[model samples]
Target: NLTTNISPLMLMVMSLERYVAVCYPLRHASIITIKNTTLSIIASWTVSLLNNLTRCLFLLQFSLEKLETLLVKDYCYDINWFPDSLRERYDKAYTCLVIISAGLAVISSYTGVVLAARSASTDKVSALKARKTLLLHLVHLGLSLSSTVYHPLLMALSTLVTRIVFVWVQDVFYVIIIILPRCLTSHIYGLNDKTIRPVLLYHLCGQLKISVKPGPC
Candidate 1:
């Protein structure tokens, strides 16, 4: 849950950074300093932690009534454990809030970059690259949010298949929906960022002793 919440928040920050870089190049250096960036990251994690702690309290409140039933359950799923009306509503509301906020941030940042890129004074090449990076961020955000539907998706699939088949389907969905997005983030950044690509390749293919040249690979 902490990762789930923090991921989008961090992406939002990254998008904002790109927006500032492209739209207000001179101000980017002054505004996006090391201390400011560090504070933003710290604040994002703090908010995510507080949000998770709040959800935990809600889960505890709802679970108290079904303590015995929960204790006997072989597997613990959040939806099954916190099936109360209030908790479910809270979960949905919070999920929507996060997704909407992150989506808007990415979209608006991209839009700003596009507008700035059109100006005669701006560097078209850099703006174009920033636009692509922002688009990837938007796609990555969607992939990350898809995990929210994992439980309901599995529940629907279970009714259509045998237990064995349903289990197989569940495993596949878990990997694609819940796991893949998190894993893909590093690759997305490494491949797209010129500075990081060589380092990433060097470590990934270390046995090959790949050269980390300043020139394009």
Candidate 2:
């Protein structure tokens, strides 16, 4: 779906934004000005629209029955959904590109953050904070990519899996993919930021600046 493709693009943009902030503090002002950021976001949405929307159009070319088989949750509905086909090939290639692009962004951003931290002559505290921030970013990216639950080998197993097993696998991983990235990661972001932390804590704890009652683990 468009959402899946855009998720990776958004991650790439955020990585670049962080990279600019840490690696090019002076240049950051001019580089990520409001107009430039707007353009970058517009570009992300445009790419997602082109890539996934084109794929959806391709599905429309097929008959109703064929399109039904080409489901978004086809892994659960049909174990053989990823069978060899032009469409499947394109889908896999698109996924590969998204992952590769995100991987490169992560590497570049993390490297910049580390280098900037080391180069900071006076602000050791800021350097430490940058490192912590990068750590959180790494964790978030992993979770966003569904690395904890979705491995390459397990993905490969999709072609070999039986129906019942594939269904269960799909169901479990779908939750991790959808809910974890969409909801919890945002909370993680808010929890780490100074301005947003108190707001989130107040809503979560039902009190401002008070010891939060232990809720669900």
Candidate 3:
């Protein structure tokens, strides 16, 4: 959950960076420097870590039930363990607060970026680049939202229905949504940029020469 939290926070920061770069170009280099970017990342991670750590502390107050196949076959919900007051009420309220705030922050950041891309740039090349950047972030935001939600319901169904089918579906979604995003993030963000493409090609595929032409690599 903490790891999931970090991605959206980082993406929002990236959107803000893009906003400054596109809308306030003259001052962007000075305003969004390496030190500040690093600090922002650290702060984002810190917030996520703290939230999840508190969750862990809450969980540690109770003992987890041991897994039993017979119990799994009979019951979908855990009979051995029940939600205490902390989780039943407080945890949900806290989760809602965090979700609302973070979701709004991310959506606002990206929306500002898209609006900035549309209105601030007149140059066709610059505008196209900004659009592409926005598209990538939109895809990221969709995937991030999916990662937080409903398919876990399928996993819950596994305990009641045929255990294998829903579990497989859950696993497939996990791989596509969570694992692929983290693993292919470099390619998704970097490979399409002309400036970065040569470096990636050279390093990843051992291509000796990437002609620095003005077209697709």
Candidate 4:
């Protein structure tokens, strides 16, 4: 009932696009062939829609008030309608499926970019910039994985001092990794203006007229 209108179809389209770009770089357009892409896109939506529909249908049969009264409201489901063991297996299977799909896409995309870079011909400065961009994306991917894996672990050990220290360290590392680069870049470019000091000082001195009156001097 509370459909947030989130379409899992978009994820499929994105995954297929990446798959084409990586697996068929030279003939991506040809191999992913418009027709095939459309089919894959449609299939992805159909599958996701069906999955959600089934879950909703199953849930609809149960009374929410009754379900909420259970001790483990989040984990508890109607075992009579769907066995507890079966539900657990389904959860594990879907979790593994998502992890594999996302992991493969990240790996495939990185491999494709690395291979493409090797075949590229560029000047030193331009090449360095390109490599830096690629490395930044890879690092971002690693951070995402670290956050997902460590999030629950951190929550579980929140009471322990050592765990608290580790969690904070990880958070700080993530913040630095994301923020330090931009700060460094700004400083590097800001230093390039040779007249910056003089110009700033001149403005601060207020020697120039404030121009309170409309008439020119």
lDDT string, candidate 2, 1-217, tens digits: 5665566677777777777776666787999988988998899889988986666555445666665656565444222443346766676787778778888887778777777777735255655565666566566666666632354445676779886887787768777775567665565457666667667788888675765343221
Ordered by TM-score, highest first, the candidates read 1, 3, 2, 4
Residue-pair clashes per prediction, in order, are: 0, 0, 0, 0
- For each candidate in the order shown, give its overall lDDT on alpha carbons: 0.82, 0.66, 0.65, 0.46
Models ranked on lDDT = 1, 2, 3, 4
Off by over 4 Å in 2: 63-84, 120-122, 147-171, 206-217
Best-performing candidate as measured by lDDT: 1
Candidate 3, 80-149: lDDT as tens digits: 2333666445546755665566567556655665566566453446545655665676577667656655
Give lDDT: candidate 4, residue 101.
65
Question: Can you give the TM-score per candidate against the true fold?
Answer: 0.88, 0.71, 0.73, 0.40
The segments of candidate 4 whose C-alpha lies over 4 angstroms from its true place after superposition are: 1-26, 54-85, 121-217
TM-score of 3: 0.73
Stretches of candidate 3 above 4 Å error?
63-82, 88-124, 206-217
Best by TM-score: 1
**Predicted structure 2: lDDT:** 0.66
lDDT of 1 by residue, 103-164 (tens): 99999999999999989999898898889889889988988889888888876776688878
